[model samples]
Target: MTEIALRAEGLYKVFGRQPQEAVERLRAGASRDEVRPATAAVIDASFEVRSGEIFVVMGLSGSGKSTLIRMLNGLLDATAGEVELCGERLTGASAAQVRGLRRRRVSMVFQHFALLPHRTVLDNVAYALEVRGVAKDERLEAARRTVDLVGLSGWEDKLPGELSGGMRQRVGLARALTADTDVLLMDEAFSALDPLIRREMQEQLVELQSALGKTIVFITHDLNEAMFLGDRIAVMRDGRIVQIGTPEDILTDPANDYVAQFVQDVDRARVLTASSVMEPARATVSASSGPRAALKVMRDLQTSAVYVVGRDRVLTGVVRDQDAIRLLRAGTTGLASITHDDFASVSVDTPLSELFVPAVESPLPLAVTDDRNRLLGVVPRVTLLAALGNVSSHTGELPTVEPPPTVPITVMSEALDAADAESGRAVPSGAQEGAV
Candidate 1:
């Protein structure tokens, strides 16, 4: 079985005056009104984060995303239930236990960089190691390496004031990296940067994640950023998880009206790819072949279009069955006379989004090709639709409506008669004749 890096089961946290009493009252069946003045946080939430997975908890402000991250690292104790980190229970752990876990096993990067104004970037990163009792020289060396890893190689001696907002966040990331924890929790880590800088930071984080593979729980309110960074996003609404799935799953198949509205504006093609839509290519004929031979080939393949390749089997263009028909009617001598540049082509690496505008502008099927234009396969509209359907079905967003149950007239009458007998009701003579 895959090891879970973090697990929270029936976790509930409420902050207010007499919180314990409020919880007791609620457990005893008192309504929210009875606990209204005291309850300030989450309620009965559960999820697990697999080791090395980027599990994102995303929501608008006050939806409990921040509170959940804090509770994960034991910054705030759960009012009820348990939180386990790397197999260690945290719900009722002592302050020392929580502190030890924070120091050695988990680290967090917040929206604010939190770098000390007096410390240089190098010292800011080295602070975590210094507190852990490493020698000055060793801590400095480790910090330098971590700084380099986050693309801050030369900014080490500068104070936070000397760096841009993005650079300051890099310092914050370096600090966490220097701690060498198994899990990293990021709370709106790039939301403060300008759009351009935020994009750059997100890309940098993706690159870093690919290399590090640390179990990460990134909290963000931005849906686009969440889609880009998360392997699986847990969308929170009104203190509950509305849906959880991959970016492709969420965009193609939303779980409810809220989730559907959230993903409505997303460009589906940019998110879907060729590998998700391409079908195996069937055998085809060359454009230079005789028109009669090409017609026979099309008929044998049962295809409307045949991919035309050269002597080396490199794709030159496509020939349609209509072209063959026209050529045969006109008594054309060769396939070259019928071939035309009416087909659309795309590289295998091209994003599915790139094909949308062109596909709308033309009726031709999009051909998948290699860098050298060698035909790989074709993407038909039906294939794209089927792929979307598959994605939707897998994500539980699209309902699979079953056909209504069929009942014979005799069976219906028998059921009615049984109900009448149970009620001690008389059955009319006309009703018995109708049942027959």
Candidate 2:
């Protein structure tokens, strides 16, 4: 089981003269408007960040996401409730203990690059160690390695002013990493960068996480960023958590109308994966099977082609009815002579957005494979379009499709119409034979 790196139970952060009393009243079902003077920055927020997971807290401005993150790091005191970091209580811990925890266990990267103007990149990164009273040479050595890790190697000697906005942000990231903490609290860390730079940073962060395995609680208002970065997301509204789910869950089964509208604009193709819409490849024949057998299976399943799998369900190639019949008539008993390996294939984790080009190009349905290239399922063009069409009904608006490069919009529209017309009959009624 994964370890819980950070946990918040019954967290509430009220700002007013009588905060605790306000919490009691709010607990008794008092609405936010009723507690007028006392603003509830966070109300009954509870969630856990597991080890090596990116847990995103997402909400618009004034939704208490920032406040909730601040309280997690002990930067702000919660009016009521407790917080634990790595199994250590942080809510009532002394200032020194909290400082020690921050120094060794958790580090934060802010929206604005918080590098020192007068200090060089190396010095700014080493500052985290300096506060811990590490020898200057040792801290600089550690900072040098961290600077290289963040891709700002030669720029270590330059002042903050000498670097670009993205570079400065890298320096800030290096500083947080210099501490070598197990957890990172990134409050809108990439929000300040331009769109292109922000995407690059997000990708870099994912790469870094894969290598470093740091538990991250990323706070962001951008839904796209959250979907791209989060293992799971907690959506906030009016200082309360409205929904907590995976990107697909939030898109497909929103908890309320508010969440539905919030995610209406999200690109569904990017969020939905092949596994969500894939069906058992109804027609499949063994590679060792003869062309006559392949043709029989195809005819029985009412499919033009049948996927050919070797031992252990590893996909070898595909056999078309015409080719099989031709081979059979030409006295070819084995499928080895006629099997076509030119069909398109994608991993089960592939997003629906990537299926269009392959779906358009492949004569057969796109094959879904595992790491071992074993055929797990198949995604038909009709199934892919039907899934995208379903996206419109859920969002209450036409899906915003940016047709892939080479696939025309008119072609997608026609396919979508056919899919809608064939609704429940997406997958043909055939027995799943030899499917793993």
Candidate 3:
């Protein structure tokens, strides 16, 4: 079972003279407007971040996402409810206890790069260790290694003003990493960079997460960024969590109309994966089966090719109908001579956007495999298109191949936009199909 690294239970942060009274009024069948003077920043917000998961809190301006993050780190006190870090309560903990916890276990990365102007890059990175009273040489060595880790190897002696915006952000990241904290609270960490640089930082964060396995609570207002990075996302609206789900869940099946409208402009192809549309492989034969048997299986299934699998359903190769017939005519009994590994295969988690090139290039349907090389299913071109267009295929028949469309993803996005416009929703005037 996966261990939970952080947890928030029925947390509320109200700002007013009589804050606890506001909580009571709101809980006792009163609307937020009823508690006029007191503003509820977080209303019964509760969620858990499993170990090593990127749990994103996404909301628009004035949604109280920033306030909620501050409360998690104990920078702002929660008016009601509780927060637990690795099963230890934090709401009622003393200031020194929270300070010690932040120093030892949790770290934060701010949107604006907060670095000392006078200090060198090395000194800024080692500031946390300095506060912990580490020896000068020891902290500097640790800082040096962390600086190299963030791709700033030679600029250790440079000041913050000498680096670019992205580089200074890297310095801030290195500082957080140097503390060796297990949990990271990132509040709009990449929102300040330009589009390209912001995307690059998101990619770097994904790679670093894979390497370091830090539990991250990433705050962002950009829907694209949230879908691309989050293992699961919590959507906030007016200080209340409207929905919490995976990207595919939010895209394909939104919890409410608010969430539906918020995600209408998002490029579905970039977020949906092959697993979402893959059907069971219709024609498959065991490797030990002879050519006659393989040909019979193809004939029964009405497919031109049949996949060959070894023991435990491990994909060995594919045997086309023509090859099967040829081998049978040649009097060959075993299937090894006829089976060929000519088909394209992708992991089950591959995005639908990435499947386009291979789906168009491959002669057969793209094969889906698991980590153990087991053949899970196949994604035919027709099925890929139907999914992108949100067209349901409930006929329970094998998807037949069609002539590959030129720029299918773009066409699908335009189709979605037209549908949204007809429904009287504002369609964003741009199409980006490969953002994932």
Candidate 4:
């Protein structure tokens, strides 16, 4: 019983003089040529946008992304199928009903600024309120507040032509804000700006969306831009949806050759985060810690890396079972005698992109630490690989269990010995559980 803000089923749209006849032909399994128009704008599209979610549609030009958003807001009627907004059917809503729905429940921002050319920014924003019959003074007051919210506090009096393209888009956004709708549909709203301005606009949109918590459907052709802003992205091609998933899923585990090629060039480190890969810190010994201690700890644990803490319990280094055995052979006794101090460690707030460089550069698992330098957890490469695989499958389900604490060396050694015995195999002297 998850609440959905918007849902569409078997959504179909065709642009032509005989729209109904075209739909009838489609229902009868007629080819495109048998239909009235040569173009098939949308075909069998269906998806749901949850409340407070940013759902993005991305495709090349003429791929029906634009047409789809228009249908969502009742700007274009579906030639077939149905669209429901906030549990209300839209495909059959009357013209006046649709107008009221757009006015009170949905707002749209287009690639073009769409501001009135001759009106001041304030007036342009107030126009939406005016259409809803708010008092002149009240509409202006609301418009002023919205203008400030969009970071155009002092430019309320300036005309659209007087402002820069980015500023104009801000006015467009402010106008949408003034509508105060529960759903915001953006159709390439930032695509008209320069690259730098586009990035800034995208950031602003993210900030606004965070504060508003509205259900948003954003359309774009730039995959990176879509990834940056969308909670989920639906990729479209040839008037059909190819795949839908989070940016991490599309990048780490593509659905097929098409999606893989779509995200092949993305920096994997930049898009993946530590939370998805990090597990609870396991027990560790310093290089000075005894081999027997390390062995005991590894035997109790089923992990690959252990944090080596100093006397203060501050992270000093890390030790893997292989390294522990190597150190044991070299006559090392304590963890301090075997720990590797040079490795990548991440703070909790570190972005997924930033973790990649360190992860790739370090031979050991990535250690996670708090501000006080206490070990929080470790992220194994295998965990990251598995997370990527799950995301690629488009399931979008996160694992629920947290990794267990690190085991002491003695306990780990005993566990390993027991495991070998249970399996009827000889225990290797140096093969111990490593920390992760």
When summed lDDT is taken over every stretch of 10 residues in candidate 1, the lowest stretch is 399-408
Name the lDDT of candidate 4. Answer: 0.78
- Backbone clash pairs for candidate 1 read 269-353
lDDT ranking from best candidate downward: 3, 2, 4, 1
User: Would you list the C-alpha lDDT of every candidate in the order shown?
Assistant: 0.76, 0.85, 0.85, 0.78
> Compared with the true structure, what per-residue lDDT tens digits does model 2 show for residues 271-303?
889887888887789988986577557555555
TM-score of 2: 0.87
On TM-score, who's better, 1 or 4? 4
- Mind giving the per-residue lDDT tens digits that candidate 4 earns over 246-312? 8876776677888888887665555666755678766666545665466556555665456778755
* Root-mean-square deviation (CA) per prediction: 16.6, 8.4, 12.8, 8.3
Decide which is better by TM-score, 2 or 3.
3
Which segments of model 1 are wrong by more than 4 Å? 18-34, 275-350, 356-378, 381-436
lDDT against true structure, model 1: 0.76
Q: How many residue pairs clash per model? A: 1, 0, 0, 47
**Model 2 alpha-carbon miss at residue 51, Å:** 1.1
Alpha-carbon shift of residue 80 in model 4 (angstroms): 0.6
Residue-level lDDT tens digits of model 3 in 1-436: 8999999998888897799999998788677778878898888899999999999999999898999999888999999989988877889999999998888878899999889999999999999999899999999999999999889999999999999999999999999989888789999999899899899889998999999998999999999999999999999998889999999999888999999999998898889998988999867899999875675565455456778999888999988766665565555688998889887889989999999999888655788999988999999888888888776666535456564222233343454455445556665444332410
Per-prediction TM-score: 0.71, 0.87, 0.88, 0.73
Off by over 4 Å in 3: 395-436
* Candidate 2 runs further than 4 Å off: 330-332, 391-436
Instruction: Say what the RMSD of model 3 is.
Output: 12.8
